[model samples]
Target: MTLDELRATAAARHDTCAQIKKMIVSRLDLPIEPAWITDDQPLFGRGLELDSLDVLELYVAIEAEFGVALYDSDMSVFGSVSRLADHVNPALAERAPTGSA
Candidate 1:
């Protein structure tokens, strides 16, 4: 998987950053600016609005969708959508190319 692959996968699920932002805003009942949830802004506390529980849910969702096992450290990588994007881009890149790798 590559960045483009991940982007394509994310887009297919309507689960990309922009889509997730809308979901979070509606789900959390948050007062947010769509512009504020950039690819890099922290997604909890000072930036977005998720807490520990939300993190867990997001992790579950990500794993379920991507078939990836994210460790604790990887969880920290998701501090912001952009940060998560950083981790995910590389992870997908290193996925052994399915049967080829």
Candidate 2:
């Protein structure tokens, strides 16, 4: 791809990550602002300090907000903001109305 196309892709990815951060903060009633959450920061443990109950809440919120069902048994997607964004954005794209993309 051309440099312009690459930049566009990166911009879109950044926008999606920002949107995901906002969604997480809003849905979880986080004390921190969305902009404060870096994309690579761990979602649980030492990073955001989230717990199992928070994970459950996140699952529900993600399903309701993004129309993506998250299984609690699968923790791979919860590793970081970027991971969640990677998982959710495609689901969002798929749920978009036909011909929207």
TM-score, predicted candidate 2 vs. hidden true structure: 0.81
RMSD of 1: 7.5
Which candidate leads in TM-score? Answer: 2
Global Cα RMSD, each model? 7.5, 6.9
Report the C-alpha displacement of residue 70, candidate 2, in angstroms.
1.1
lDDT of 1 by residue, 9-95 (tens): 656433455655664565556687664567667787887667888777766655665455565664456666645654445543254
Residue pairs in clash, model 1: 39-82
Query: What lDDT does the true structure give each of the candidates?
Result: 0.59, 0.79
Best-performing candidate as measured by lDDT: 2
> Looking at candidate 1, what is the lDDT of residue 69?
52
